[model samples]
Structures are given as C-alpha cells and as structure tokens.
Target: MAYTDDEILAGLAEIINEETGLETDAVQLDKTFTDDLDIDSLSMMTIAVTAEEKFGVKIPDEEVKNLVTVNDAVTYIKNAQS
Candidate 1:
C-alpha cells in the first residue's frame, strides 16, 4: 500500500532523526538536510536504508543526491511507495 504525504513525512522524520541523533520535532519542512539539520552523506545513506526498509521501496542514487530538503525526502518516499 502507498503512504500518505503525512505518513511519508513521519517516516522521514523518524529515519532522519534516528540517523542524525536529532529530534523529529526539530526538523522543518523547508529545512535542508545538510545545511539545516547537519545530516551528512553517511547519515543520509542511513536514512535511505531506513526509508527503503520501512517503505519497501528503492530510491535511485541520482535522485538521492538531488534531495536536500525534508520535503524532498518525503516526496521521494511518497513516490517510491506509490
């Protein structure tokens, strides 16, 4: 089954928070993962892993690099789930 935007957002928050040791409530929709949340490559990779496992989806490498913001990850998750 596909996830809703809210569900995607929730999953992203959980994954990102867990990977970066940040609070989900601290993330903003427009915040850049790198600049704002301080999520590095390794952490992002972990986020990807978590997202893939949680949603049962594959995110392409090219698309992954382009994702800089929380919304970007949520959008990717939503599309992947669909």
Candidate 2:
C-alpha cells in the first residue's frame, strides 16, 4: 500500500531521531533540516538511506539536497507516491 503523508513524516522522524538522537516530538515541519535540526550532510545521507530502506524508494542526492525541512521530505514522498 502507498503510505500516507503522516507515514512518510514518521519515517523521516524515526531516521532523524536515530541519526541525531532526538525524539520525533522535537522535529517540526518548518524547522530547517540542517540548521535547525542539526543535521549535517552526512546525516542527511543517512536519512536518505533510511528512507530508501524503509520505504523501498531510492532518494536521489539531488532531491535530498533540496530538502530544507521535514516538510520538504514529506512533499517529496507524497509526490513520489503519486
């Protein structure tokens, strides 16, 4: 089954928490994935890996680099699902 936006967000949240040692509640959609969430380039690669493994989708590095916030990832997943 295709995942919902909430599911995508949750997946990203789990990845963030795992890589950054932060809880899901600490992540906000508007928060910058790097500056606000303290995610570095390497951590984002890890997040992309998690997303690919968990969702069975390969996230392009170009696409990943465009992600500035949790909402960016959410939108990408939703669009990919479409």
Candidate 3:
C-alpha cells in the first residue's frame, strides 16, 4: 500500500483541511504546521491521530513533534509505509 509523494501530500492536505478547515491548496511541502498554518497542539494531536488512521501508519506521540512541516510529515509517513 505504498503511496507516491503527490498522493500522500494530497491525502495529508485533505486531512488537514478536514481538521482545521484550511484550504487543501494551502498545505505545501514547506509550510510549518504551527507557524505557518497556525495549528495548535490540540489540532496537531488530532491531525496526527487522523493521519495515522488514514495512512495506516503508527505515528508515535513523541515523533509527532518532529513532524514540524508538511514535508516532514509526508516524508515520515512515506518512510513508515515502507
């Protein structure tokens, strides 16, 4: 069930949009979830949980912090799938 980066990005963007009401196009590779997107910790946690379920990957609590940017999360999930 591996996904290309574009597919992952689109799916992640959709998740972010659903959780935060953000436009899917606003989610870019370099956008920081907190600084750029203004995502609070609670939203981040929710996004992490949702992403885990959607991507079928276990994103540990501690590792969530390391996922600072959209690209960071995309890369982590891509690697986790492998």
Candidate 4:
C-alpha cells in the first residue's frame, strides 16, 4: 500500500528509534539525520536499507544525498509510493 507523508515519518521514526535508540519524539520532521539525530554515514545506510525493506521502495544511493532531514526522507518515500 502507498503511504502518506505522516505515515512515512512515523515509520522512519520507528526505524531511527530502533537504530539510534532515540525517543519517538526526537525523530521529528525538522530534525536532520546527521546533525540532530547523530546518524553517521553508516547508520544512515542502515536506516535507508530498513526503510527500503519496510516501505518497499528502492532508495538509490544517488537519491540518498537528497534526504538530509527526516522530512526529506518522508517526502521521498511518499513520492516513490506514488
């Protein structure tokens, strides 16, 4: 099923929480994965892989550069679902 942006964000929150051990509230749309979430390149790759598996959307490496913030990743997933 296709997901909305909010659903994508929530899924991402779960993934981030699992990977980073962060609180659900800490994974907000405005939070940057690198700066705010302290997600390094390796962690980001793991998140991206989890996201791909969960969302059933292929997020290519080239497209990963565009996902700087939580909102960016959610939007990318939503767009990909469409």
| Most accurate candidate by lDDT | 3
Query: Model 2: which ten-residue window has the lowest total lDDT?
Result: 73-82
lDDT of 4 by residue, 1-82 (tens): 9998888888999999999899988999999999998999988989999999999999998888779999999988988884
C-alpha lDDT of candidate 4 relative to the true structure: 0.91
TM-score per candidate: 0.90, 0.90, 0.96, 0.94
How far off is residue 23 in model 4, in Å? 0.8
Taking the tens digit of each residue's C-alpha lDDT, what string does model 3 give over 1-82? 9988999999999999998899999999999999999999889999999988888999999999899999999999999996
Tens digits of per-residue lDDT for model 2, 1-82: 5888888888888888889898998777788887888889998998888887888776898888998988888888777763
Off by over 4 Å in 1: none
lDDT of 1 by residue, 1-82 (tens): 8898888888788877777778988776899988989888877887887788999899876777898998988887787765
Candidate 2 — which residues are off by over 4 angstroms? none
Clashing pairs in 1: none
lDDT of 1: 0.83
Q: Scored by Cα lDDT, where does model 2 land?
A: 0.84
Note the Cα lDDT for every prediction shown: 0.83, 0.84, 0.93, 0.91
Which segments of candidate 3 are over 4 A away from where they belong?
A: none
Q: By how many angstroms RMSD does model 3 differ from the true structure?
A: 0.7
- Candidate 1 has a TM-score of 0.90
